[model samples]
Target: MTAMLEMRGVSKSFTGVQALRDVNFTVRAGEIHALVGENGAGKSTLMKVLSGVYPHGSYEGAIIFEGEERRFRDINDSEALGIIIIHQELALIPLLSIAENIFLSHPPARLGIIDRDAVYRQTRELLAQVGLREHPDTLITDLGVGKQQLVEIAKALSKRVRLLILDEPTASLNEADSAALLDRLLAFREQGIASILISHKLNEVARVADRITVLRDGRTVDSIDCGAQPVEEDRIIRSMVNRDLAHRFPERHARIGSPVLEVRNWSVYHPLHPERQVIKNVDFQVRRGEVVGIAGLMGAGRTEFAMSLFGRAWGRNITGRIALEGCEVELSSVPAAIDAGLAYVTEDRKQLGVILADDVRKNITLASLAQVAPRWVIDDVAELRAASDYRTRMRIRCSDVYQETGQLSGGNQQKVVLSKWLMTDPQVLILDEPTRGIDVGAKYEIYCIINELAEAGKGVVVISSEMPELLGICDRICVMNDGAFVGEFASGDATQEKIMRAIMHNKRTSNGARESDMPMEGVRP
Candidate 1:
């Protein structure tokens, strides 16, 4: 069988980084080829070269598709040849309707006027192809992340996309949604549409990929063909991280201490829909030298609860009683919350975590500019020192403290987000999906950092979709559902089944955290 696409002698470099080097990749017709690699291994960079984001003459490579060599000067040039790339961060406009977004660039028209009926009529067909039941007129913001992903596919189909590129499509989706997306990819393969999938989720790759290509440090490591033979998950992990990852989490010698922060009868309403209550009457607390994790589904109010408590950054009709060291405090704004010794790390890191264009030194000192600046003027020396210290301590693999956060890898970008919040010197830290896009190796490092923070007598609150992560690092795991806390389990007593059962039953099982259950560190699923 003739190959659908091929790349020969591909190499790309940035100012001081060689992101890709003489990489060779191939995909067959009607095949779902997965590109797997650790963060910063040149996976995205290679895709950029293919999709024309890097453009012709920018990288030394040959991209052959449909048995013809081509040079794509921009994304539009590549799209003209039926190649569409959907990035991890969705490009859909929240305010626009689904049909409008689907054909925003080009729509059916006569006399230079768009045909609304024609647009909706064609949109319905595309939506049905992707199994999205929503009406074409529905707003993109009204849909969940999973549905939005399907909408993206629908948009691609509208363009007659022959070769589709999905970058970490399921990284933010839940299990059921991820399965549905994979099923769609399989369906597309049967219909003769080739796909290049990039993801950190090894299980999905094993299940869906016909062939897997591994890239390590800007070079192709190996290619595994599932049709020829099955590949082990551990082997794939070893190839990506280049080490025996015997454990995904680090050791934990926890010493549970006194209560550091508490909240009582917390309630918040939706900012846009005033009548809709987002967070119901909720009571939560975290103790000194303790890591408390909140477990829940996507819309289970985990993030809303965290953001509402953090200076009401999320909701409108917010009503809550918060206390620090057993004393009630007012947190009406973000600055006030920081002043009250509270820091919240948001789940949507790319949008809300740090300024991507800014350098590491600036982002680190942004949250604590007052400390670095003795007067109202400036202090570059102190700021650079603090940022450099964090860069070394956090193991942020960058050229230097002056390196832009945007140019770094996902794991390093996450570390910079942590550095900014840590510089605030808060007694209580709330981390939302701290390691969402991070790889397994980097995840263990982050777990170790959390343990270190707890050992320093700081209260930590973690919100993650991964159950094993919560069970591994949290002293107590709290099951949240429908804007309320239903149950709590100490580290020892907490299991995936038990915690899921708590969510299913929708009832509180324990009164508070207990240190006697088990240690969360070094435990595997």
Candidate 2:
């Protein structure tokens, strides 16, 4: 089969840093090719080059598409050639309707007038092709992250995209939603659309990829033919890391102490719908020197529960009693929670966790500046010392502490966020989706850090969508379903099957009760 896209001896540099060196890659028509690498290993950089974000004369490379040499000057040039790249951070306008978002740049305009009906009709057809049940008239903000991803795919299809580039498409999706998205990708493949998938989820990559390309330290290590025969995950991992990964998860010593943080009859109402409750009467406790993990699918209210208990940052109608070190405390606001020795690391780091334009030292000392400076007068020396301490402790790779946090890799940026919370010296730390976009090596380091926190006698509460990560790191796992804690199991006792079964059981029970109480309307079965 002839190659759909090909690159040879691709080398790219930025301000004296060589991001890509002598890289070679090829993608066949109607094939799903996976790109795997560590953080800062030049995966995104190479994709940017291909998508014309780097332009023609900026990088030294030869790009051949459909046996024709092409030099794209910008994203529009690449898009004209049927090459569209969907970034990890979605580029959808929240207030716009689905139809408008789909046909944003190139609308269905007739005679210099926008045709709304035509746009909706075309959008509906595209949505149906992607197996999305939502209407084109719905607003983008009204849909979940997974459904919004489908809209993104539909937008790509609108451009008649021949080569689709997806970076961590399923990073925010739940298990079922992730599976559904993968199925859609496979369906696209059957229609002869090629894809370049970049993801940290090796299992998902192994399941869908027709070929796997491994990159490390700004160079293409190897490309393996996953469709040639039985593809082994070990073979791919070896190629990517250039070593045998004896164990994916690190070892942990189980030593749980007395309950350090407790929540009794916790409940929170939906922010948008004030009357509807999101987190129903939940109860749990985390002991000192113990890592407790909250596991659930998307919309399971794990994050809601944590945020409500920490500082009432998310929900509106919050009714919860939080006790720390045997003393009940009132956490009405963020300051109140911090005053009560509590800290939370938000999942959306780029938007919420850090000030991107700020330097590392400034962001590190943001949360606990009062502690460093006793009076209203600022103390530069104290702040610098505190930030420098955390920089070394967290192994944050940067030329200087004054460097901008935005310039760092995903792993290093995550470390900066962690450092910010650690400087607060809270007794109970809540980490929400701590290892979301980072690589495998960075994940291991984070796991080690969590263990160290537990060893230091601090209570840790982890909320993760990944089942294996929860099982590997937590001392105990609590399963949440539909705004409630349905089941609890020890790390030693919990299995992926049991957790999934509990969620399903709760869903069935809830549905049965709802059906018995409420009258059936226009609901489709």
Candidate 3:
């Protein structure tokens, strides 16, 4: 196969900090090339250089495509040559229809006017090619994450993309959706479309990648050809981190104790639909020094339950009894929830976890300003000391406390989020998809943090879509389906098969109906 794209000796630096160091990468025509690395390892940086996000003259690099040395001045220059990149965060406008988003920049025009008929016709064809069965008029907001991903691919096809760059495309998708997306990639491969996939999911990489490239500390370390021999996950990890991670998760010996957080008959109604109940009456408990995992597929209402528990931040007509260490607390608002020693780490870190525009110090101190502000005035010295303390404690790698949060890598940014919530000194913390897009090394660090929190006698509740993650770290796992717990398991007893079976059995028994139809008084998992 001919080389479709090549980036040779590429280096990018940000304010004296080198993000990429002479990295070399290549992708064959009609091949799926997987780029694997730890956060801050320069994978995304290298991709940016190729896609013109960094642009020419901004970075040291040589980009060769189809036997031609390309000097792309901007993303438009790259796109003009059939190179399209879909970022980790989907760039579609929520208010626009699918057809509009697909052709927002380069719509089919007739006599200097946008052609609505041609736009819809082309969008329908692209959607069909991507195996999406939706009308062109459907709003981007109305589509699910999986469908939105397909829309992104469809949009790429609109530009006649020959080389597709997808960054963490399936990080937020469930198993079925991810599989569907991968299948589309395989189909694209058959049609001679080359793709560069950047993902943290090793299993998925192994399944699809024709070649694998490993980058570490801003440099390319190794490139494995899957056609020559099989690639082991451990080998890739070792190359990426420069050390052996014998265990993906740190070992934990939980010391369970008395209940620290308890909820009885918790129910939440949809904010928009007054007649619909999003969360059924549920009983839940988290004990001191215990790590509890909530395992559920997408749309299982896990996030809804967590948000409603945290001062009714997400649902309407929220009725629940929350007791902290045997004392009933009134969590009527976010401030009250914080005052009651409850903290929630959201899944969408970029949006809800930390302020990207703010510096690391401000983000770390944002949640507990009162501690750094004595006499209702923020003391700079005290704030700096507190923020620096967490920066070291959380192992957050950044230029300094003054560095912008957005400038840090994904893993480091997540540490900042954890540091922010930890400053609140909460007794019980709920982490929703805590390590969603994080790499293996960073994931281990996050797991260790969760263990340390539990060891400190804090009740920790983790909600994750990855079953293996829950199994590897949690002491207990609860299977939730259709807004209610269907089964529970100890760490020793839980398996992916068993947990999934419980969810499937519940769905079968209920015939896809929610527990909301039942009376709230006697409902139990």
Please identify which of the two predictions, 1 or 2, would achieve the higher lDDT against the true structure.
Answer: 1
User: Which prediction has the highest TM-score against the true structure?
Assistant: 3
lDDT-sorted candidate list, best first: 3, 1, 2
Per-candidate TM equals 0.95, 0.94, 0.96
Minimal lDDT window, size 10, model 1: 516-525
lDDT of 1 by residue, 384-480 (tens): 8999999989999999998889988898899999999998989999999999987777888899999999999999999999998999899999899
Cα lDDT computed for each candidate against the true fold: 0.90, 0.88, 0.92
Where is model 2 poorest over a 10-residue stretch in terms of lDDT? 515-524
Name the lDDT value of residue 8 in candidate 3. Answer: 89
C-alpha lDDT (0 to 100) for residue 236 of candidate 1: 86
Off by over 4 Å in 2: 507-525
What's the CA error at residue 387 for candidate 2, in Å? 2.0
